[model samples]
Target chain A: MRRQLLFTALGAAIALTSPLAGAAGDELNFDAYREMLADGNPAELLEMEGEELWRTARGPKNATLEQCDLGRGPGVVEGAAAQLPRYFADTDKVQDLESRLMHCMEAQQGIPSAEIINGQFLKGERGKLAALVAYVVTHSKGKPIAIDLSHPRVKEMYDMGERAFRYRTGAMDFACSSCHSQDGKRIRATQLPNITKPEGAAEGWSSWPAYRVSNSQFWTMQHRLWDCFRQQRTAEPVFASDVTIALSVFMAGKGNGAEARWPGVKR
Target chain B: MKKLFLALPLALGLSGASADELQTRVEQMMLDSFKANGIAGLDRQKQDAVQKACSGLTPPDAETMKKLEAAEMATIKWPTDGNFTGGDWKEGQKIAASGRGLTWTDKTADNNGGGCYNCHAMDPKEVSEGTIGPSLEGYGKLRGSSEEVVKYTWGKLWNSKAYNACSDMPRNGYGGILTETQIRHVMAYLFDPASPVNQ
Candidate 1:
């Protein structure tokens, strides 16, 4: 682990000293640093672990999630993330991959909902829900996001999502649109992705579940949204709640057709 | 009679409500989705007039913006002591550089950082400074602390939305983000000639 960190640091140091650095007035050099770290994203470990979790039988019901349907057929994992945040007939609601995963854990494996909700967000850690999500999303990598809006519930979610994105209420009065609607903006050396347009939203939404170097953590989209809500100074969103799924639908839909670039590296 | 009474429930389903039902349901969802922790309460999700207007899916018109700005500006609380630069610059520097505060994990409410460096280029030496807002590197040197400059700077830091209703910047004073003394320290950090911001 120490050696790996050294190699990562060396990559960062080399990129920081490059003449290309600071040319964009990005003296903090976050983009350059991220490019250097891209070679060995830590999210890879999580993906492998998620695959293990999907096949292993360790839960209360002694069942694996291999038979769980993710918008495709039962036990289907390929390209499922490409059309996520869709309506699930069993639950009769619109759900993102994480929400659906939670439902499966409860229904298929009989794992208590509360335990999964409060579970740690680690990659290799036991019962880490994010790791399983990583495994599922990995299959859909590079596929274009194609959210299905055929269901009326899906439309309702999308509509609510649009409203939620623009709704500003907090101590800071920051809506998601505040930092993202504009172009060429950064918050402390980090570029805020514009999630208002198809191209920008796709680019923004596509490269999530990134491996953050500063914290050495693999963050899923749900975790990313959690951080965003925290920064917005709003109440902590319940894990995989309707509001979260709706926002995912809104963003994933806007970014529809943007290639899924999962397990991205970040500073 | 019991059957008729039970049939009333089916009657409700037969009767249709508004097509705008999704919007109303989403509102309820929003209420149910979040929970308060630490210093942040659920009430933080309630929108003020300025926030409501500014958070439109489309940008509000100029006429709407003017009215919202006026309402937002009225919320700014000026320094009661009539002194904006009386606090220490060293403390100001820490506050300017910090981006921590008001989160659920945060321990206290009094030590919130201005997070100024998160969005503005403060000291030229601080390469990690953000570019979201304008640089204040030579604030005192470029624009001396004239009466108007001092007042305007103070107000800007207090309620950024006063001048620009839709600004991405937080309303530090109006939002209870910083105490007046902390704002005073930030004032000194900007205007003090000895501060690195000027050099």
Candidate 2:
């Protein structure tokens, strides 16, 4: 696959440049391991299913989502996911990919938003949505993440999102910042990215909608954030809520100009 | 009354809201976004005074930190039997290794993990230990079980904020995340000569 080739090429480049020693060398080795696992990611199977669903007519209206608008106009799958969490005029609100999909599924396919809003991850409507998310983000692979923060509402959401990032609560007294505000830290063995910085935010934001090897399931960004709050010992957030969108805006906006590596493979 | 005050600005529009007003809006938005499920309730979103002081963009001033630490120190419950590090180190090792409990999936509060290994190295041989907190690989060997050391360890485990106001470490005893017996076991795990942490 293209990503495998890219990783192999990157690994070779790093091997040629840096002397194999210390943390950087360890990181290069980890990347090589990741490249090995990333070959034939399980999310690819889901992506294929999503592509089929996108073209198939099966919703209440018996309509395919081929005409669904993803902020690049109707049926425009190319590079659409790169510029999402944008202000949508039709709904008079800012929406990320999943929420926008909820709209399109409702308006174009006659499927209700509640089907996903109340649904569990990788089950029922949510499962279908995850597949669709995989298909959509794959189009934006290696594209620069460029979310617009010009809209007043969007700017407001971004500010609030930054606040939410630092808002510590729950039994453990954790904000998203608790784990993510620093670089080169880990929770147990898993690496944590410092989402306050550009590179780290991009690493956190763009690499998700990933295939999680541990659970053997594809996790969209919403699913990832939901579990983050769960681990923080907080209450369950409603699916695709404004708070989630706001947090997405903060991340994507901060990560502006970084490459999106959606449908990423993860441990 | 508090809900109405928080909700009023967002009802009109957040366009003209101040930084403080926007913070209030974000808090309300969080309150609106989450719902109680299983044992995890919406009340978990509520921040205590100590949590509020620490959740700022920067750490609170030194005076406020001292006050907060003092208040937190008052909450520590020293072992009633005056026996510290008396429990089995084996049980403590299990508690230290577990990163479970308090999530919605967990059925009971009594069965919980110290989650110590999630942030600190217990046994020197454990390669997967986290680096968030200092490594405690040879806690007993390095800092012998003097009266002062034992008492400080007990208080720190009970309420980490008692020592540092904004420590990332959880209040294992104060938060009721671990029981008294559990804490005692973890103490032994750190101090016991037979424990792998000391070996």
Candidate 3:
């Protein structure tokens, strides 16, 4: 089968307006496809589930995440994810939204961090976390990415992230820069965003935590980064590790002022 | 090794010592963050001289480039048997097309793919090719199978950095990404008249 024709059985309407009919539609334009699925994004379902999980009283402590602080303040979900991967004074660690959420779950709800950390994606505790992520990022939709690198630790993470981006190792000898540093590049028809630049960083950073049509699952940014490392043929970074958070800090800080398009749909 | 960097700054009283400090810290961070899983291990995180040299913001100096290339060239394991293009082109097609192996979930390291199509266009019919490297559609047809051309191609596939110091192409043979027989098969896929790559 042609690679571009490998569209999933999501929307029957997509099949009707298939891009294959046109001469110029040889390759799938993800931008156009994203727009097509805008009204009916599957991430909305996960968002709803996340909202319920947020307010519900569960976990060992029998507490909801309603009082969890997401950088803005306790229980402030609006525009919070836009400025994530920031240094949290309470934890004294630079954390992304997922990592921050992990803290909240652990502290407020008495949920062990190990459960989510060691768990696989779209299953059990990790799966619930994915939903929560979808919910949290939904509030930050259309808000500018405003990461603060003023803190010394956050600055260190940003520096670490920049170095990590160029640090090529593994069997493939591939770095994030190998494919992403250049503009207008692709890996077998898929457009690789040039994440070094602000626009590219925004495009890459903001549109994730997405619902994938291929796998039929919502993937958090941690899952996305994990898979990137997997494809790089390097050892997997632990869930919400410093390396992952540092990489996030680099991308988010570089992507500051770009609008968040959270709960995105992807092929 | 860890203390050496910390001691250097204090000993020399250097003002801008954070460059080496950052490198050390990042290396330690990677070691701490990543854990070995199945086929993939923490050992892969450690960068060799060639990898480290090429990973810098700028390419290594001309002298260093030559040294790196020479060192990489020494690592290529040339086919013991003179016959390079005798392998099946059909098997080569599968090897080039696949982008699997060495990942954590992968069962074993053997039978890994060359992942050629990820960067270069091999078969004209295969539209799912990346434009990172030049197209190899008419590789054999354009460059005939002379002894020099065959040897050059073999070495190139084995370790691309041998020819170009910081070539983006992976060191397939030197890196143990593909086996000798698998590379031979890929050679056939590139040079064989019956191969779709030539057509």
List runs of model 2 lying over 4 Å from the truth: A1-30, B1-14
Tens digits of per-residue lDDT for model 1, B85-186 = 777888899999989899887877778999999889989887766666888899988999888999888998899988988888898888889988899999
Better of 1 and 2 by DockQ: 2
Q: Write the per-residue lDDT of candidate 2 for residues B4-109, one digit (tens) a residue.
A: 7755655455656787888778779879999998889999988899888887899999999999999999999998889999999999999999999999878877
lDDT of 3 at A113: 97
| Model 1 residue A119 CA deviation in Å | 3.8
Q: Which pairs of residues have clashing backbones in candidate 3?
A: none
Q: Rank the candidates by TM-score, best first.
A: 3, 2, 1
* Predicted candidate 1 versus true structure: per-residue lDDT over A1-267, tens digit per residue: 854775577567655565345444645456655676566666777788789888988667989898899989999999998899898889987888888888888888887777767655552222367888788888998898998754556666776788888778777787787677767677876777778888778877788878776676778888889899899888888888878888888888888878998878766
**Candidate with better TM-score, 1 vs 3:** 3
Q: All candidates' lDDT scores?
A: 0.80, 0.87, 0.87
Q: What are the per-model DockQ values?
A: 0.40, 0.44, 0.46
How well is each residue in A1-267 modelled by candidate 3, as lDDT tens digits? 322232343556566665433413244456667787887777888898999999999899999999999999999999999999888889988899999999999999999999998998889888999999999999999999999866666777888899899888898888888888887777877778899899888988999999887667789999999999999989988999989998999999999999999989887
RMSD of each: 6.4, 6.1, 5.6
Q: Give candidate 1's error at residue B50 in angstroms.
A: 1.7
Give me the candidate number with maximum DockQ.
3
